[model samples]
Target: MILLFAGCPQSSDKISKPGSTQSGTTIHGEKIDISETELLTALNLTRGSQSASEAAKKIAAQTGKNVGRLSFTEAKSLAYDDEAGTFKVKVVGKKNGKNFDKTFNVTGFTHPYASPPQSAIQVEFKFDAGIEENLSIDKYIEKITPNLKAHLTFSFSLQNGKAITLGYDNDYYELTAQVSNSNGELKISPEYKLKYKKKLRGEDETSVSTAYTSAMPVFTGQKKDYFTEKDVFEHIFNKVKDDPELIVADAGSYASSKYAFAMVLNNGGTLFNTGKIAQYVNVYNTKGADNHREIKNITPAMDNVRGGGITADDYEGKLTVNFYISKAEYIADGNTPDDKEKSGSYTVVRSGFKKLPSDISSNVRSVLEFSLGKITDGNGTQDTWKKRRINNTALISMKYTGINSTYDNWFSLNDDLKITGDTSGFYLILNGQDYTSRMPNHQDNFLVPTNGDENVKILIKHLQISKNVGEEELTIRVQFMGGNDTETVKIKPQSY
Candidate 1:
């Protein structure tokens, strides 16, 4: 059965600000002695045994009357009142140096990798804080007003982590944040950057380091930062010249998800190519009009622009993406490829937004399941549950359409149920040797086609168990999201 799995609080909002960690005691300011951890605990009392109230009490007690200007507040679970389908985050703070408490409602999602698999991964909603989706950053903020102000929406993304890896050096991870007003207009996006570097120690040892201001470009102040292609679609639509502009809007257009851009650009009556599309992007390549933030090849990136640099957030956009389905799912014979089920143009960012094929569900909840029987040791020992070279009791039949996999999604039971040192997404195979997308969960699209004579399949492969505080006969439930309907399947692993 699916239950609340909270061991070590398997999730974190992780909203860090422009501050120093050189602790003498506070975070944003002194006298404000609270870490992000304390802040989250105080904000979300549902996780612990504490609650602070406001009426005549300035700061209600959590432990031995340990209260400050800000206090441990209240929270409402999903089983209570909420329209946006999110939990309530109430905080008591000073509005203008006075007693103020407001419950902030939030719509957030737990990345499957971030939480225990037995729990409802969609406990809240939305996807991970990846570069792939345009997720609502203010999931925990947007609703707060009065005494408390300031909300920060942040995304942590590692797009092509090792951009220029000369024997593992110069790795960059992007942190995007936006400040929203009441009208949701007149906002600013400050790109926080984290750079990773490794120093080789002899032949077998190496150390790594990072800094947010490590290699930041001096492109702020009066120096005008430009907008990316995605910034045009999301923010400045009027400046968009042609359909090609919108086609190249997503971050992945230039490098990774190029197929969708190439296809859509050509169909829009422009003989599209990299050089041809870069011409349209050139419109924004100037001081006043450019994609400085999203400009990959630029030497030093614009970490924090004063204002206006809406360059391509090109992580994910569905200007248009077509799908190719099997004959059995299509139901009808088509004269051309475009006449198939998902053959038409689609503005698909999050599935079923504009259009989607009925058979080609974006996320197939368990259309299938397996009796993920017991997992044993390498020596096939049922005596004790321990890690061995190979396990005797592993659910070899964790098959979803029987993933005809050539993939060895191996992981150490050490980190986040990681697949080959990475704990994010599985491979999405498409034409021309894996149109491999670093798909953020519930954000990017997944298409399945038989590889030559290989059968179309998606297998669970393996389930990584870390600790011992577990449940029995874990029924894995998959929620298949369609254009209009939602289908759910719970797979109860049986003994093979």
Candidate 2:
């Protein structure tokens, strides 16, 4: 339930060559190994009569081909039938099926696109609602790649400055609740296909020295899936549900638990609502047999990213990107931290981010104008906003109009398709209040118009400022989508 997170913050330090090994945090100065990923997860089931380990066993038993069994075979689905004594194939939409690994692969593009709109993966798919044509990441693929979308940390950049995004599946796993498990149990590992096959050089099976050869596109993980909301509690279970009793968590007492994830809990959480049970997808403590507790009959972890050789955890920041100069630490297997059975490599990736310009030129400035400051937080807020018919509700707003120009411009068009919940087109900091996450005007995608638009000799729209913000000075940082450039607009009452 407690995940130990470790990583080096994003730095300009040079990284060692791939094929590294280490344990805990001690890198042994070597090539990056892909076997260190040992996914950690726990299963909690409510049955006052049963012990915690027993609850874990029952979930695993029912997950296998038959109920009351602990061996995983090729036919275990998230759904199962415990015939009072025996468990068997689960019926999904009337047909018995094991969750097959879905594949999504990206190549031909590099990280740090040479320009905006072009993805770092070079592959871009757009949404076509009528046909659901395996659409762009804007569609389903952006979701279920095992919970949270992959951050830029899992990517590596080549000399060409193009990055190969390996993604979150290359590092972490989410404890997802199964559709039927209210208090039953949720699979920690998501079912979207993100599993990869390791291309072992030979059949040694003992030595990982010749495990991989980067001859031609060694990444075997093919992309093809959707995004699913994940619980921060999954990443930190014990903290959220420290009590041994599942009913307590169900009674909503977990909400007041001092260590619960504030972000999720504060917004009215979706966890432990009717009580809870955690069904860890990767319960590797198979004290009886081999790969028995693995979810979906997958070997080791629920998928490769969780078990095979990758390891990652919540960095606990609004956003914290960490990279390691490819290294590996020695972990002594299940019994001791002395053997080298499993190892995964994480190395410092080449940063392809371009440095922002030191100054915004007048031409860029000419494109938009901030309205004269007539800030008001009067009680007639509803009437004022209603007059404008703005979609975003806010305490106060200022006009940021466009100037006549033929060039393409945007307010906060978030072009990065890889990350979710991060489409802040623009940010407003009134005094010291951070209003990046609550921008009503341009929540995610709002395109700017050029001179060609009939009404726009120049048309200004209001930028919503959140309630409770101080009126010291309004600072706006707009990320113009034209070329992924940022422009600052600072306004003071007297100055404006």
Candidate 3:
């Protein structure tokens, strides 16, 4: 919306002289002068709703000059000054071989922003040379024809309880008339084309963004003048009222019917150093004692596993215990006869798990053993392992555990969600986090299921990971109900 006020001079400045060609020189070969008092009287008589030609004829009659002897070249009015109760109009006319441009300090002219009947819209005119020759309204209309076939359009809006006028300036040789619409918001854009002898020359346009007000009476059967704020609210409410899934409630309220589960393992084998297993169990027991008052009430026996022992067979088998232990010890008899009576204890252990221990619900001791037989049994590269770990972790972490159907559908339609990097749809997740921050405030945190069905569609909006991870295919697994059925969708690597 760049506004250019090019070629318009200040009203206080003198009107530019017509071209120096002999054709432009005023007729009668001598300068003619009309008294200011007579001119003022004629102008006053023409003030209220009189066409420019009618005013010209009256002025010609009073000054004893034929209407053909005058040319109305320019006219402009300053903004109304309420305190002074006056508005200034500058007019440039040609008469008797001389240019007569004068500013009339006028009172009682209707203010464009005045209230009710007093606030009528007015138009002042300017014409090219010789256009005012016959001095009739029809003759005036004939000279300045629109280049566009349509009538001049206008839009209106109220600013601070007053109408803000939008029109082209006088320099463009275009005339404007005021028409009003009751609803400002319904106003159409105003555009006009200038034509000469039916050939298009130029255009003038204006746009309005405001609520409409009636300058004149609206017809009896027309729609109400304007839309109220409540009208907008009800319109939106009616659109979504029938959708039961769009209602919002707390996630925990539906926990009885909804279930979400996730698990991750490195090759499905569990291992723990025997000497450090006791310390790990003790730590878990301490954490549960310090943090889990609710769980303590349900499982009071959880505190009794601190002194448990790990046998030599457990160490050889690489078994994983399901209870907490802080540390472990190994005691051996001294080898020398002198030291036979003395026994010493030493800690010999490897890496320990950092996560809190969970109850061992299964009894398979071989579950911790690798089916691949040994560490060197397969073609296991670090790059492949790293990529698999990253993909596995990402797949498990990306889950829509609960339902969210109250999101605004308007935002989903308009915003760019980058579905498949080529198509457009709602973005559910990016880099394992919800895409809610990119959406508007009213939209929910998660995407809704399509019509509350068992199948969930996950659009892979984007993928950005380390180059070392290579081109990995991702599998999205969705479980709608607890152990009922699972749906899987595979997404291949795509170029950005």
Against the hidden reference, what TM-scores do the models get?
Answer: 0.19, 0.15, 0.16
- lDDT value, residue 416 of candidate 1: 26
Which window of 10 residues has the lowest lDDT sum in candidate 1? 297-306
lDDT tens string, model 1, 5-102? 76773332321222222222122322333443454443353321111111102222232222444433332221111111123333434322444333
Model 3, 93-181: lDDT tens per residue? Answer: 66665866554444442222333222324222332211112122333334434421132323233222433233544211232332234
Global lDDT for candidate 1?
0.25
lDDT of each: 0.25, 0.24, 0.27
- Give candidate 1's error at residue 42 in angstroms: 80
- Candidate 3 segments whose C-alpha is farther than 4 A from its true place: 1-80, 94-105, 110-496
Pairwise lDDT winner, candidates 2 and 3: 3
